[model samples]
Target chain A: MYSRDEFFLLIEDLSLLPAISPSCRSAFDKMEDPEASLIGIGHLIEEDPGLASRLIKVANSPFYPYSGKVGSVREALVRLGLETTRGVILTTSLFDRIRGEAGVYALWQHSLAVSMISRNIAGHLRMPYPDEVALAGLLHDIGKIPYFMHDASEMHRSISDVDPGRPDYKREKEAFGMDHMEIGEHLTISWRFPSIVCAPIRWHHNPAKSPEADRTVVRIVALGDLIASAYGLGHPEFPFVDGDILQLTEELNLLGAEVTSLLTDFLYDRDLIVQRSHDVF
Target chain B: MARMMKVELATTEDGEMIVQDVHDMLGRLLVRAPRRIDPELKRMLLARGIQEVFIPDQSSGDAEYERQIVEQERDAIRKRFSRLQDTPDNKRIVEIFIRAFEVFHAEKGKIPPV
Candidate 1:
């Protein structure tokens, strides 16, 4: 059993740990500038031809769903908005980093589903920052990526052994001395993500325990995660819905009929979601 | 003009031909068509927690009736939940779900059901 400190050391030593690409980092920084023009951000992204091409690909993917093809990074940035564009670049870079690792595809698929669901939930709730919430959903399970990088077999075993009735984090803690949420929280903080985004990644499995300011979005994300799990979107080892999820739904005042409709819609959309995930990953 | 109906997978017997291929939520093909479902396949579907499969009703393919069913369900949902105070949050959430569903339906329509 690895101690928490030892696990941190292991993460440090792992070559496959997620690092923002220099070009992406530069592009993100440029976008952050209050006076940065769309053209300026586009130029920075174009500096990395590979990232530029991927941005265009993702922009054209179902997630964006433009009537016509996105011809350049500028078009993608304009259409997807700065935050979502940054998320696409970051997500693609992260996927590239862990592409061949066992279970990466499954994880990516799960993340995409969660992200889509989160955005939907946020949209439903009329939240001001739906894109940010969506981005948070995409990165929620990212902590597990390092484990896959270090020990693919053990990670696969853990996922396979996941019992839906119990929190998967507890099992992870017992095995590795820390859960993916904790690792993800740390990683997001290092990446300088806002507290709103980091909070959901950390507290999604247990929204009631989140900080008061962050609870609403956390609850939204938690519900989204449960919805994705219930639909068996990605890896199936995790539980779909539990007591906490039920309680959260009630607290949110989501009606049973609404939930049923949501499920029906999910069923209807499952195929397209899967196809989009493959395209992104 | 497709009407949705639920088909129980548990009650399906061996040698019963599957009219359409069944897929899981992730869109992975669970059972292929042109073949009869056997005990093993049934067990596999059950183990995956798939209790039922929803398919288009072949007998009455009335598109308008299907649309009415959907509208009625939406109306019932609205009425049942209407007692709760209306808030921008709730309205937005419902709208988002609706939009998401529309996108899904449009995209799904473009491809043949597997």
Candidate 2:
């Protein structure tokens, strides 16, 4: 029923897997604890020289303006907190692999918009793990990559805001036999991502009424999407969630001020997202 | 736990819960199907630890969605996943998904196979 060529874009190249990122490697080596951090994460990253270089690149980025030019991976770690450093490495590595249309840069902007809005929403609500919410929000639609199936960047813009729940993803499944969410979830699992990220991915698109009404994490991602839609930065294929927001607000017993506050942060961070897409990506 | 009827993937609602449960149970194994669960959407869900080939259920549709659209897309997704089963990576991937549901939710309630 649909004519689509899937590129498995989101599916991580199992072979190209770099162990981890540089800062993660250095910090993991210094770590006494395993669960909170790991040595393998850093060592794996150190394996990729490219990751090492990117850490320096990220540290130099205006996000972390170091007074003195402290040059070294360990110094880079100190300047960018260990976790943020790790995020930088991972983000860079992931970005290095993505190839798409000229508009992909714009798509990156949308992702960052969602990511920024998600963090703002989480913070306004005093939700824990703000960074995670931001990361997930930014990469939420990462699945769409392979949906374009390594084709021209034009393919992405070409996709109308068709009901992704309808024909676009359905057709994508027809072409590749798996949707981007499935691909992304598998990639994360394969990469050994924590469940906090994985669970939302599964439920992000379709939140469970009963469990969502109760669980904080579910509410977080679901809410993140809502805030992102409200921000007016577009992930077109994403559900145009307006009317549902009011109903969801009532159902979640949320106040209107809570929503307004988040939108404010979103606008605040809009520059970071725009800059990151152009500079970082 | 007794795994429930291998969670059905007929509807988007079914798809969400089924995918969530499978993902929760899978641990390191990735079991997410990005395709939103809805009647007639082409989807493969491992729910309640059972991997079921879903053809959207018309009986479940109310005012918004019905069988006409659901069935066509399903056939498309079916073909998609079937092709994956033939690949080396996906072959192992699917097995890992099934094993995860089996081991994790064996006591919850098993969902029968398709």
Candidate 3:
């Protein structure tokens, strides 16, 4: 089994980890700066034509109300907002680095579903930093990426062999001496992601254990992940533990009937969600 | 099967029969209707850029058909939540999933409206 030190060593050694392009890294830095303007970020994105076009396409995606009107990278960045653009860039950049590796594509699909669900749930709840919540959902499963990178076949077996009663992370713990959530927390923090975005990745499986400041959004992401799995949008091999719906709803300041209504809406729009994922990926 | 339903081609299961002929933009016949879509056939269709298809709605019919679909959907939901103990809270949560699925099917005209 891999030790926690090895995991940290892998993350700390920048040369050993997947490389985020310098331009992407620079853009990320500018995004985090309070004084940076949209034009500055747009110019940085334009350094990579492919990335710029992708941003434009995402701006026109069905997720935004301004579809077909975003004509440039600047406009896309402006329309997507700073928080969401950070998410889009981070998600796209990280996934792109390992695009063809085994299980990566399916993982990306599941992430997209969770991201969309989280965004919609946040919108419905009028939560602060809906974009950050969406970012959290998109990167929640990132802990698994390193394992797949190490040994694709072994990772597949580890995930498949999980007992029904235990979460996938517990199985990972047995195999690696550390769970995906722990790995994800370290990786995201090492990459300089904000605490709000890293909180869900660290505690999505057990939101109650998250810090009090981030517990609400963490719970939102956890619910989104569960709902996505229930909708058959998750990896086919993974099973989920039951979420305490009563506790979650009460904590979120929502009634059970309200959640039902929200779910009904999601069900009605599931096809659209699938199409959106297909388009983005 | 009583009525034809528009379904996402990716979600179509093996052995489900297509209800219409699929043609390319060039008007060339790609696949004929009344054909069962196996894994290979689904791949070929998807490779040709077909994302949606008309299929005989197996879930549309009398009370028995609705009951069967509900059972299947519930079974799927239950399996997703199989890890949880049989507690009142878990039961309510599973019920929510089942109810939302039924509502989706009903709204899509695959069954009687709720």
Candidate 4:
């Protein structure tokens, strides 16, 4: 059994590790400023030419809804909005950190799929902050990254043995002495992300247990995770849909017909979405 | 001219015709008939995680007809769920799916008809 202090130390070690580049970090920090203009945010991104170029690529990529190509960082920022821009920046940075690791790319692909699906579900339901939920979906499994960094093979083995029919959280806890949700929540909290985002990361596997106020968003992310898994987008270890998915959908007031249509849409779009994920990541 | 093709059962909607016996992943025969597909069968297929089944392919001369059928099904499904669309939560989900679909089409060309 791992002590709580061990988990805290893991977080501390992760904090000390070289994760995001300084320029990306600065760009993220600047995004928090209400007074920060698009140009200012653009310039901060420009400091890291690679990130700027990738941001433009993503902005023009099939992910964003816009038609025309975004030619510059400023245009990308204006098109993507602050929250999605932050998500893009963080995703790119995190991808850089774990680019070549076995299974990491696949995990990122899964995360991106979940992010897109979460945003879709939230927007369809007219949630107040869909992008925040998207961000949560993107980072929900982030706690696994530290474990991969520590021992990729061990982490891979642990997840590979998980029973597909059950939620992987308990297995994760048993294997690593801390589940990904706990580690993810702690990390996101330390990153200063709002509770709206952090709570979903912590409770996405079991949305009914989340605080009543945050339940909707948490359920959306949870559904997104399930859909992404169902579509075979990312990590294969936890591919089975949780039995509670239908119940959660009902609680969120999504109609059976809506769920059917959504599943149809996903079925038709799965290959292309998987392809887009590979291209983006 | 029509031929038979193995397709994922989950992708088959109600009214489609199955051409052979459907079996679960464990090889247990679930449905044995050249039967017209229905919602209950689809649900049972999905429940067992059965990935593929043989189906009659009438997509030859009636490609337009097939497309129309798919569109109608999609439309009916949408209308049924339309009441939820006005809410912020459902709206965001629809917007995201549309955006993702648009992007996929733009980047990879149109997805071929299933």
In order, the TM-score of chain B in each prediction is 0.40, 0.27, 0.52, 0.50
Q: Model 3 misses residue A148 by how many Å?
A: 2.0
Query: Alpha carbon lDDT of residue B23, candidate 4?
Result: 65
**How much of the true contact map at the interface does candidate 1 reproduce, as a fraction?**
0.01
**Candidate 2 positional error at B109, Å:** 61
lDDT of 3 by residue, A1-281 (tens): 56767755665564223466777777888887889988898999899888888888888987554546888999898788877786777677767766655345557767877777787788888986777787888889888777766656566666555355666677778767778898888888876778888899999888899999998888888888888777756654453545665677778887777788777776755666655665666
**With candidate 2 superimposed using the best TM-score fit, by how many Å does residue A94's alpha carbon deviate from the native?**
3.1
Candidate 4, residue A243: CA error in Å?
3.3
Q: Count clashing pairs, candidate 2.
A: 31
Compute the DockQ of candidate 1. 0.07
Model 1, C-alpha of A97: deviation from truth (Å)? 2.7
Q: Report the lDDT tens digits of candidate 2 across residue range A118-150.
A: 666666667777766666665566565544445
The candidate, 1 or 2, that scores higher on TM-score is 1
| lDDT of prediction 1 | 0.67
lDDT top scorer: 3
lDDT by residue (tens digit), candidate 3, B4-113: 76655656679889988987534668888889999878765644445567887665456766666566667767877777788888888889888888888887777785
Q: Please state the CAPRI-style docking class of candidate 3.
A: acceptable
Q: How well is each residue in A174-201 modelled by candidate 1, as lDDT tens digits?
A: 6677898998888777666788889999
lDDT of 4 at A27: 85
- Score each candidate by Cα lDDT: 0.67, 0.48, 0.74, 0.68
Where does the lowest 10-residue lDDT sum fall in candidate 1 chain B?
Answer: B75-84
Listed in order, each prediction's TM-score against the native is 0.69, 0.53, 0.80, 0.69
